[model samples]
Target chain A: MKSLSLKNLAKTYFDAYKGEHVTAIRDVSLEVPAGEFVSIVGPSGCGKSTILNMVAGFIPHSGGEILVGGTPVKGPGPDRGVVFQSFALFPWKTVLDNVGFGPKMRGVPKAERDAIAREYLALAGLSHAADRYPNELSGGMQQRVGVVRALANEPDVLLMDEPFASVDAQTRMTLQDELSRIWEERRPTVVFITHDVPEAVFLANRVVVLSKGKVLAEVEVPISRPRVWDRLVADDEFKDLSNQVLALVRSA
Target chain B: MERTSRISAALIFIAPLAVLVALWAVVVPVFGVRPQIFPSVPAVGRAGLDSILDGSLLRHVAASVSRVAIGTVLAVLVAVPLGILMGVSRGVSAFLTPLMRFFSVLAGIAWIPIATLWFGYGFGAIVFVIFNAVFFVVAYNTLLGVSTIPMTLRHAAASLGAGRQAMLTDVLLPGALPNIVTGIRTGLGFAWRGLIAAEMIATDVGLGYMLFVARDFYQTEVIVLGMIVIGTLWLLIDRLILVPLERATIERWGLVSA
Candidate 1:
């Protein structure tokens, strides 16, 4: 059974300034079973982020249905965690507290929550920087904290919106590897949105190519797991999938 | 190293005052300036010492300080929470912002005549003037602060399962604090000046009263001493209290400047 599903998903809004109606996404549908990592890749303004936001329940979809564990998504809840591209770590909170915030809000005891946060921070290689404020950290480190913060909540599904798009290319690759390793261990259902075809193919079991508010193609990655960046990029399977996805995005 | 820098900072601040005093001593004596216009430096010092010995200076200082403390505390207690509540609703803020701006502009010395008439010419009148000066400015600033917090932070908080009370404590209050502290600093400045003006017009005791009463006897030394006291008090409050508080909040919560 699919862990998460979007059936005939659509979103529409009134452009008050322009005095016109705009459709951000329409009739797009996909499903991800538990423990699957799916990435949606498209050109700018293709509404990939909109789909993630809809699944995260941050915004109401104008039409269609989104289900988590076969239940309809009503609104944002701890069951689905989100990592934003901008690394929205609370500036006022320390790294430890930022990671622990979700559990704390759910009324987890201080000791238990801190312990949960510590494990996640360790996974993100941020244990030494736990006491420092978000502003004190590098952009990559802050986004690592952002990832751990979502993970610490123990959500069934993780929704990431171009989570590493802002980081330097080298740091982005490192973070991609780190996130993939963490995903391998935790095995939560993840829906990641990005514009980079290589990144979508590198980290996802399947890449969904979208454009003009609709999914154009869904390409499965035949590259095996426990994938290394250099080895994966050099492989024929990776090249074929990346080229196919790139072509689809260009056409879309 | 920290201590040495701190001491240097203190010296940097004091050096100007030392230069001012030296310039006053040299220029006044060199120009043969009359003490009547600006009291000779020694004469002002002597006058300050005389007030200190007579205990009248203490009384005036105490009176002024107490009125400011009571008025400020009362105003902050009510204004902050009220401002935050009003700020929560765009409709309420839209309706009330103009009223707050109007009242804040009319704050302080503008209220002196009406305040004295309402409360009579003693502690009540002085307190009312100070309260008026502080209340409207603080409330208006608080409203601005709450309104400026990014909606993304609020959404992030809600998505993390923070309820209403948690949202207020963790998000709203902290988010609004930098603006609130800034408002207090500005309001206090207005209130301090208003206090002196009100004391001169309505009250028989306080630094303003001392200055006005000294004018009757042509005691320019006493007037100079009162002015010094007022300047010192305001400087101390701003540098030592409000400024530090404002800096801490902004540094802690503000977006790191690009």
Candidate 2:
């Protein structure tokens, strides 16, 4: 059974200044089963981020519906947690407070919230930075906080939008490994969106390619878990999938 | 060059003041001006010491400071939350902005005649003037602050499971802090000026009254002394308190110079 479903999802931007409408997503639909790591790959400004925002309910979709566990997603709730591209940690809050913010909003007591946050912090390998502010950390470290903050609530589905896009190559690789490890342990349904083909192939069980608000293709990665991206770069299956995805992204 | 000089530059500013003072000490005598018109530096200093010794100076200073303190505190306590509430909602911000800006322009000295008429010539009248000076300015600035916080940040918080209250406490307040503090400083500047003007016109006590009373007695020395005290007090508040607080807020979470 599908854990998350998108049905006839459409989004349009009304250009108030120009007196026109632009369609970013038009009747697009996809589904992710429970505990499956799915990543959506798309060209820039192709409504990939908008798709995620639709799922997270940060923006009102111009039309259609999104469902998680058979209930319509109207607005943001603790059931689905989102990690933003920019790692939008509350600058005034320490890592602990930021991570615990989900539970704190749910009216969880301070002690219980702290315990949950502590568990996620440890899972993210960021226990030492719990008391530090976001500004005090590097880009990769900031994303770690973002990830922990989302997972602290023990969300049913974790949503990530170009989460590692800002990090350097070394940091991105390390973060991918961390994400892979986290997925291996928690088994939460994840819907990650990225433009980078190699990243999608390295992490996702299924890669959905989108172009002009439509799903172009959905390919399943046959690679085994505990991925070593560097080693996998030499594997024939990895190379072929990467080349195909790269060509598709480049053409679109 | 601007950065380096900002780091090292000080005391060059003192030279111009020293020259002005030296010219003051010599110019009056050279021009044969009467002491009543322009008291000598030594005479002003002597009056300053006299006021200090008699304890009247301290009382007047305390009175003015206390009124300003009470008024500004009350204004911030009231203004910030109200401003944030208005700011969070499009309907409220649009509805209140014109009204708030209208009143901000009418802050400080403009309120004097009505304030005195309403509250009578005492602490109430003086506080009313200061409150008017602070309330609208701070409120307007706070509304602006909340509005300027990026929409994406608020949405991000919401997606991360932050509710309405958490969004306010975490994102809204902190993001608006630099502007809020800036508003307080500017508001208090107008407040201090309003306090002095109100005190002169309506109150029997405080620095403005001290200066005005000195004028009645042709005590130019005391008048000069009062002006000096006002300048010094303002400088202290700006340098030691408001400026540092503003700097800290901007450094921690402030928007860039854009």
Candidate 3:
């Protein structure tokens, strides 16, 4: 695991429809120390996804320096793993193969990679699903695979873009719980992007609220460990933190 | 239950062709149709028996099937890599797409006349026609398949440490497989028609040649037998081989919508 730093991040693009230069992200800087879970929350079009994309190296930032473990970010690399909201599991690959894909790319032997995949699948509580195709699983189950597939690579930093946004509310909570458990156990640096206020607070060590491509506020969550929706749902500290982050988002 | 349904489905498919044959059997004899135009069922059956006994039927069928198999394999081998190359590079795809569209329309039997001129009216010519028929459609569909893959899947693969070769094998290839299979099916449809047409014009030892030569001699029974063999061979190839391949991969994997 490694720390992530974004210094003076800015994005400006030519808008074909508007026929003018549009600035999406304007001068934002943030740091996520190694093993810390930082969730960036904002309303739609606030460039939250853009920030994550830039960090993941999926898109080039117009002006910025993104450092992962003190190394400059260039393009997408194995050091940084990404979990997308779309649950982009390879439909043609069985669950085991999908999870094993990263190790396979690294030229790990078949038996060793399969073992690694199995271990990760167990971590996500998805051992029974190993032989099935992605389409055979429900949306939630697919996302569980997505999370483990990323984790199996053992990347230095894990980037998630609204990973739970598309699943049902109930399933989302369960996924959040699983993610929290995984993070506690593995302690990989995470930069999670979402629009949900409670979700941001529930999962992050600190929540960074953004508006119009700039960080509006950063709030620390002192909520105790092993955070689950069951307890966090009724916890005053959790509610207060969520409300504080919600206000920052709304004010933005 | 599945076995019964499969049997019933086969029966349902065969019923219409059986009825057509029955209608032909009754009409040809009852109306006293000229044997020169359409031979009696028994006459056609006799011709079939004679060809089988003489081993001519096996030779013609073998010749045609081998040509199609060789041509399709070569076309797929070349087209898949080219299509993937086009899929990854916008400049290449943009330049080639228009060319592919234009040539695909001229695929199949249209190429036979030129093919014969180039290859001198033999195996080369017929195989060229079949290759021409299969190549463009598969390449174009492969391009469609690769382009249609979601961007995020590529992103995920890249972030998971996939390099150029791994990206092709692990993501682009499998991601494009459903369409590749679909393309092969459609291209082979064209190739089949083109093969018969080419064989008629160029080859001396195939089912199409059998039909064409029989026409000159007014041996309508032989022609009818050749037609039956051609149709039956295609049905068997498509139903037994291609459909099952499609079901085992794309359909079973739920890659395509029902």
Candidate 4:
């Protein structure tokens, strides 16, 4: 695990239809210490996804320094693994192969990568799905594969862009619980982006709220470990923190 | 259960052809049609038997099949990589797309006259025609396949440390495979027709040549037999090879929506 720092990150693009340059992210800077879970939440078009995309190196930042473990990032690399909202688990590959892809890219032998894949699949409770294609699995199951696929790479930092947003509510809660458990176990630095307020608070140690391409505020979650919806749904602290972040997002 | 269903499907498919043959048997003699116009079923059957007994049918079929096989293989080998290269670059695809559209429309028999000029009237000319028939379609389809791949998949691969080589093999190749297969199927369809035409004009030892020679002698029986062989060969190729290939990859992998 390694610390991720964004120094004056900005993104500006020319909108062909609008016939003008529009800034998506303007002067955003933040620091995520090693093994920390930080979520960036915002309303639509607030650049939350843009920030994650930039950090993941899917798009270039207009201006900024993105450093992982104090080394500047030039492009997408194994040091920063990303879990996309689409689940992006290669449809042509079986669940096991999809999870094994990272190790395979790193030159791990077939036997070793398969073993590594099995271990991560076990972590996500996806062992039974190893032989199945992504399309064969449910949306929730596919995202589980996505999560573990990133984790199996053992990257310095994991970037999740609204990973659970597409799944249904019940599945989202279950995924959130599983992600929290996984974070507690592995303690990998994660920067999660989402528009869902409670989901941001539920999964992150700190929630950053953004508005109009700028950071508005940050709320810290002091929730205890092993958090689950059954216990936290009605818990006062969880509700308060969720409401606090929701208010920040709404106000933004 | 699956095997039985497949057998039943085959039987259903054959039923109509069987009925058409039976109608041909009755209609020809009942009308007392001249053999020169349309040979009786028995005459065509005897022609088929004569050609097979003389080993000419096998030789012709082999020549035609081998030419098609070689041409398609060579075309795919070249077209797939070229298509992928075009797919990866917007400028390349944009510039080549219009050319691909024009050439694919003019692919097949249109190339035969020039092919014969270039390669002479023989196997080379026929195969050149077949190659042209297959190449443009496959390349165009491959380009379409690569371009249609979701950006997120590439993002996931790159972030997972996929380098240039790995991205091409692991992501682009497999991701574009379904379309490539589809292209091969469609291109082969065009190539099969082109092969018959090219063989008639440019070759002395193929099914199309057999038909053309029979027409000179007014041997309608041999002509009808050649037509049946051509149609049956295509059916077998499509059903026995292409469909199963599609099922094994595209359908089995759930790449295609229901």
Clash totals, every prediction: 0, 0, 0, 0
**Candidate 2 error regions (>4 Å):** B1-33, B254-258
Instruction: Give the per-prediction TM-score of chain B.
Output: 0.95, 0.92, 0.97, 0.98
| Model 4 stretches astray by more than 4 angstroms | none
> Comparing to the true complex, what docking class would candidate 1 get?
medium
RMSD to true structure for each model, in Å: 2.0, 3.2, 1.0, 0.9
Of 2 and 3, the candidate ahead on TM-score is 3
Indicate whether candidate 3 or candidate 4 has the larger DockQ: 4
TM-score of chain B of 4: 0.98
Q: What is the TM-score of chain B in candidate 3?
A: 0.97
Computed on C-alpha atoms, the DockQ of candidate 2 is 0.53
Residue A85's lDDT in candidate 4: 94
For candidate 1, lDDT tens digit of each residue in B1-258? 999998999899989999998998898889998877878889999999989999999999999999999999899988898889887987887888788878877888888888889999999989998999899888888888888787766766766777789889888888888888888999899889999999999999999999999999888989989998999999999999998898787876555362
Descending-lDDT candidate ranking? 4, 3, 1, 2
DockQ of each: 0.56, 0.53, 0.87, 0.88
Error of 3 at B91 (Å): 0.7
Model 2, range B1-258, lDDT digits (tens) per residue? Answer: 987785555466567768888999998888987988999988988998888999999999999999999999999989999889888888988888888878878888888888888998889888988988888878878888898887767876887677777788888998888889999999999998888888899999999999999999999999988998998899889888998898887765424452
Question: lDDT of all the models against the reference?
Answer: 0.88, 0.87, 0.93, 0.93
Number of clashes in model 1?
Answer: 0
Candidate 1's C-alpha runs over 4 A off are B252-258
